[model samples]
Target: MKPSILTISACGIFTTGIAFAGEQHLTCPARLEPDAIQPNHLPAGWELHMLRPVYLTEGGMLHGPPEESAFLVPDNSTSRKAGKQTREMQHWSFDVPHGYTMWVYCGYGGGGATLKLFQQVTESATECTLSSQSTNGRTKEVLEFSCK
Candidate 1:
């Protein structure tokens, strides 16, 4: 099958559904800057993927009530703004093929932050969600992607 290309605008619009074959590309919003992240580091044949957003609430401070839970669609202006405070919090989804490794580069504050890549045991049409494990106290950051 021919490769599929998917692009997401800074305004949070997706051009097309993800395609599993060939090379797939993902475009970051204009608001985001390029940092240390490089897509060339990813394994071969890996393509950029996007997924729906799911939000969960955690219990507030000691003896505090549970925080409100929210679901994000990742397809509008509001959801993008919510991630402004912490770029990592902004949820990005990707469909990574099994046995393939993808590289994600992220920055926080003045110093650089580390991202831990986790593999989801369950696979659904190669759809997987991508987010920062932590923003490292940085209000602004950049994300770059490259797939093999």
Candidate 2:
């Protein structure tokens, strides 16, 4: 038997149950627009790619204890050319609930030394703050953002 679909509203739809002739409706939460949820204090020159939510498992192995939550914002900025190769620097913003420390890594393309950048934690109730640092001729770098 073919099931009949009924329009409930913009949020969901109703349909006849497959097992029986009973009416069933599926409801979903309203979706929020990107601008409506994005932070107002994003850096001046950086562009927001997307918002990422992170969940850590118990007993953090690589770094810290598990059961930690953090939000990551991956962004793309202007390209910088070092020597003959033009490379894109990696930019990341991290938001953690509690006070925590993180590290950023930068490396050159051709067997060059790697540079480590650190983040300065700024305490705020609504948002996290990330410190801006120059690549200093490095081709790519990872920036750590700590939010308290």
Measured by TM-score, the strongest candidate is: 2
CA-lDDT, candidates in order: 0.28, 0.29
Give the per-residue lDDT of model 1 (tens digit) for 9-45. 4433223323345333332321322322235445788
Model 1 segments more than 4 A misplaced: 1-23, 30-125, 129-135, 144-148
Give the local distance difference test score of model 1. Answer: 0.28
Worst ten-residue run, lDDT, model 2? 55-64
How far residue 4's Cα lies from its native spot in candidate 1, in Å, is 12
Quote the lDDT for 36 in model 1: 23
Identify the runs in model 2 with alpha carbons over 4 angstroms from their true place.
1-74, 77-89, 105-119, 123-148
TM-scores of all candidate predictions against the true structure: 0.21, 0.23
RMSD of each: 18.1, 19.8
